[model samples]
Target: MGSAWTQSFREELSVGKVKFSLSQPELLLQPQWSISPLAWLLYRLFMLLYTFIWCLYSALLFSSPKWLLFLSHIVYCSMAMYYLLALCNLVWAAIQVRNFYRNAAANQNEGSRVRGGSVGPFPLPPLLSAALRLQWCLHNLVSSFSVTVTLLYWMLVYPIEKHPLSTFNINMHVGNSVQALLDLVLSSTPIHLAHYVHLFLAACLYILFLLLYWLSGGTSLSRKPYIYKVLDFGRWPLVAAFSVIGFICIGLPLGHFLLLVPLKV
Candidate 1:
């Protein structure tokens, strides 16, 4: 069984005959379970509202001095953007549905047969297509980033911290993961095993940010030279490098695999 499962996972990672599509807008709009699209839309809207409001609260809490240092804030911002894109995808879908029905009605009035399985003149509009692509990319990004941020924070940063965590900190770390998991379970969004590349790329980008910050003499809110103690490149360069490499190579793929299990259900 282990061998077979490993083989199956390997097949997913195969680059041969790989294909991706954004032509089916329904797959983007509809839920995996038998639920109304409106329900999904409403859920997305609520998430957007929550994340947006909390982002504002976090801004106030940090008060701009330390806002840019934390990875939590960056991931939270990405989550907000993901939810916003999701909401826009739904609204665009609704518009297409309405137009489709209106066109059908007009055709019926003219005594012409309406074509079935057509939504707003077939091939989706260019703008909607672009939006769906962006939404898909962000979905993959947030899934990995949220889980990584939560695990890293709780395991590495929280344990050695001298101060107790605030509600905002807890929400940013724990709640973000919950939101991402709920999105995975509740929606029809597809997760491709090979898409772990997105996570790896994001990890690399963050490492670059750390290097730049170090070079620029940026500090944490506590006025420490590094953002997080574990990631303090200047103080413990080897350890920090290994931590990033491990996350990019192991942590990201593991998180993506966990997400895939839910989708397979």
Candidate 2:
């Protein structure tokens, strides 16, 4: 045991001790949102509405057996899948927003209110939240690809092709491009070139699907065994060359531009 020695001190003395604690600001760790809550909510509603309208239009066209024949085209197939993805993303975003609002309300004990400018609540574990954000990024990237493909087809392919205009008219070509562009603009994810890999993969899968469909004896309305005359497998060399050029030059660049344009704002 040590002896307690009394010493004379001139400094201020207090009966109780003072404690100091340090805390990290939540903003430092929270994910940065690219858009406001109100904007995102309105965009979600618009996507849901646009998806419903497209589905109804497709259903009406499918009612006719003649119109059903046009479904073999890659344009219709890709646009259909794009809208479906948009609907899915919309649902996920809605759920996230709801949870954000609820959490903000419950956490009001800390004097933080759920407002349009807030970071919004994210209750998901770190890994799960990251995965969700990645999915959202890929989803928007695909939306950009859909728009690029649709416009390229319309301006370049459809104009030169001799396919029946009646069949094409029933497929809602303009609407598909417009809705996809809207989705791309309304997306809150920051655009990154690395995400372009998802677009490439999607294109590759679509090309494979077209090849399989052709192998199964699918024929377009023009009586051509190929959906796009340029993609006719009979000329494998031309098809390969065009695919390479399209992916590298047209598809990648177009998608990159489409995604970056809105971000420039």
Candidate 3:
């Protein structure tokens, strides 16, 4: 039993293997079940627009001077980028479809001249292929990271920070997770077990940024040494370290697993 379970775990990780792909762009752009691709496209467009408007509003509300300090803003930007890339992928898919039909018609004409000759479907352009892979990675990263940020914000940051519940606050914290959950459920994007590494790396990068910011005596807009009191590594290194570990090691994987449940169902 132990050996069998170990093998199953190994297969789940698919270690040393390239788990991502640029082929079958439909898998990234289309819906999972019978929902129309047009519907999915429109939904993605709506999300893109919604996130953009709020992001612009946020920029104006907070102003440009303090935009870089907050992790919430970073995650919001990531969310916006994810949707934007998704829209681009949909456009690419549409172009690929049109090209496929055009190629087929041309091949049919050529086949009459040279009987039994045919051509395969159109291949993705090199640039679009790379963009699809980026979209896939962002899909995994944003899905897990948005949920983690939401959980940490409401559970940890809200109480002590004592920030009043406002529209922007709710939108950034709660609405981001809602969007992620909807995307996970509605989209056909596949999530791999090892993809959680993206979230882990992002967490590590933020931790490094925190250390550097502290070392350089950087401060939040409020002029606090740390970005968030929970992540105040300078004052409470152990707490911050454990928080990062818990989110990256525990929260992120669990969130990814939960997101997988919808796909599996």
Candidate 4:
């Protein structure tokens, strides 16, 4: 008992009271979120929060310096508003799909051994399977191409020299009717218009994912295995994420939102 007590205290792993405090944060570790749809939803939520906080932090950082803060807000507000609008719209769609599935499962599972397997196998004919796969492949390819081009513009082109607004493929067609109106009203600059347009295209892919998710009615058999399904949902987001990583690799010449105009000396 004496040696046990000595060894426990001597080891770095044991500190008794401090262990509880140290491990408190780990209690929030989310195993349920290991699955894809859940994970993607969490990720989307976090990114939305992250952008919001990042903008807020930037705003507060320059609070004492009014001119600089206003300048900072100009960039932050322009970018953040679009992000917030898109994020909320996507979240609402996801919730609609989720609730539709939940109510659906409740209806069809009166006394079955299974939960929601009544969705049964898809009636996809051989032709349709091939066609769906082809469509998926094309969707992924175009999505990848868009990611690549945008990253190239942000990293290589913008870093060295400013390009004309005509360079980027900026078409602003996002959201439902009401949200689209907000996007149209808010988006004025060519650069911001370009960003918002790409987001709109990305939103379409997400909507397609949501459509597939609910079309199959969000059941286990109605879905792919959880891992595959999550990967499927994350496909386009992954492209965008990695492309952003490439942009981060280039990073900024100095700090965040530093130079919009080319310096002349």
TM-score pick, better of 2 and 3: 3
Candidate 1 segments exceeding 4 Å error: 1-7, 16-20, 111-121
Better of 2 and 4 by TM-score: 2
lDDT of 4 by residue, 35-72 (tens): 46556456546645654675566557445433221212
Taking the tens digit of each residue's C-alpha lDDT, what string does model 1 give over 1-265? Answer: 7887788778778774133466466777778888876677788899999999999898887787578567778888888999999898889878886887787778877767555634344557888888887888888889878888887778777886744677887798899889999888887777788887667778788889888988899888878898878788888999888888877887777777778876644
State the lDDT of candidate 2 residue by residue for 149-254, as single tens digits.
Answer: 6666566567768446663353455555565565555444444444555566656666776677778887765567776666677666586558646755686668
User: Lowest-scoring 10 consecutive residues by lDDT in candidate 3?
Assistant: 112-121
Clashes of each: 0, 0, 0, 0
User: TM-scores across all candidates?
Assistant: 0.89, 0.58, 0.89, 0.27
Pairs of colliding residues, candidate 2 = none
Candidate 4's C-alpha runs over 4 A off are 1-35, 61-75, 109-265
lDDT of candidate 1 at residue 227, scale 0 to 100: 82
Global Cα lDDT for candidate 4: 0.36
TM-score of candidate 4 versus the correct structure, residues matched by position? 0.27
RMSD of each: 2.6, 16.9, 2.7, 22.7
The window of 10 residues in a row where model 4 has the poorest summed lDDT is: 256-265
Q: State the displacement of the C-alpha of residue 67, model 1, in Å, after optimal TM-score superposition.
A: 1.4
**Residues 1-265, candidate 3, lDDT per residue (tens digit)?**
7787677557667864236765566688778778876787788999999999998898898776567667778888888999999998788778887987686778688664424554555677788878888999888888887887787787888988988889988998999889999888788787867776777788789878878988999888788888888788878988888887887788777777777655534
Q: Which stretches of candidate 3 lie over 4 Å from their true place?
A: 1-9, 16-18, 112-118
Error (Å) of candidate 3 at residue 78 is 0.8
